[model samples]
Target: MDNYARLKQVWIAVIYLLLLAIIIPWYWPEEDVRQFYGFPIWALLSLSGLFLTSCFTAWVCLGREVTKE
Candidate 1:
């Protein structure tokens, strides 16, 4: 409920928004066909983005301090 906490939350939200943007393949060309390890290139990128988002969320959750009010 303090300024620092609010700022931190805003930064976290911005990062999450960026990650969400990366997870979507809107930038990939529709006609392009490429595969890596049996998976499409876009699919691979999206999956990796999801993985990074998950890791970031876990790190934020696990590293936060709990305060008793």
Candidate 2:
């Protein structure tokens, strides 16, 4: 596989991990962890990192040229 295809696969994996981080908590028993700025710590940190990483990935991907086979 070429670089573009590889990068797309990696991006999809990152998105899958992000979704897992967002949803896996629902199956766990509730516990009160220390809040970050009045929001759940996981939501604040995990989602912020996910969004930033996604933005950076998109920015980098925009400049790449995918050659046809």
Candidate 3:
């Protein structure tokens, strides 16, 4: 519908995807020992990207305004 609504939908989808990534091992398996900075590679990268993407999306969405203030 509107930019604000579209942004909210994107935000919700991203959050759901992030939750799925956290609960389900998409790239890395349970027995894998590969680590990045002492943390699981998949876990670290997936979460960091998720957080950063969410923040960036929010910031950009905030910048788009239909109302004059």
**Which has the greatest lDDT?**
1
Better of 1 and 3 by lDDT: 1
Model 2 misplaced regions, further than 4 Å: 2-29, 66-69
Q: Rank the candidates by TM-score, best first.
A: 1, 3, 2
What digit string (tens of lDDT, one per residue) describes model 3 on residues 1-69? 999899887987887677666645666767888888888877787777777767766876687768878
TM-score of each: 0.87, 0.45, 0.47
TM-score of 2: 0.45
Better model by lDDT, 2 or 3? 3
Q: After superposition, how far is residue 39 of candidate 1 from its true place, in Å?
A: 1.7
Model 1, residue 31: C-alpha shift (Å): 0.5
Q: Which ranges of candidate 1 are over 4 A from the true structure? A: none
What digit string (tens of lDDT, one per residue) describes model 1 on residues 1-69? Answer: 999999999999999999999899999999979999889999999999999999999999999999999
Q: What are the clashing pairs of model 3?
A: none
The root-mean-square deviation over C-alpha atoms between each candidate and the true structure, in angstroms, is 1.3, 4.4, 4.5
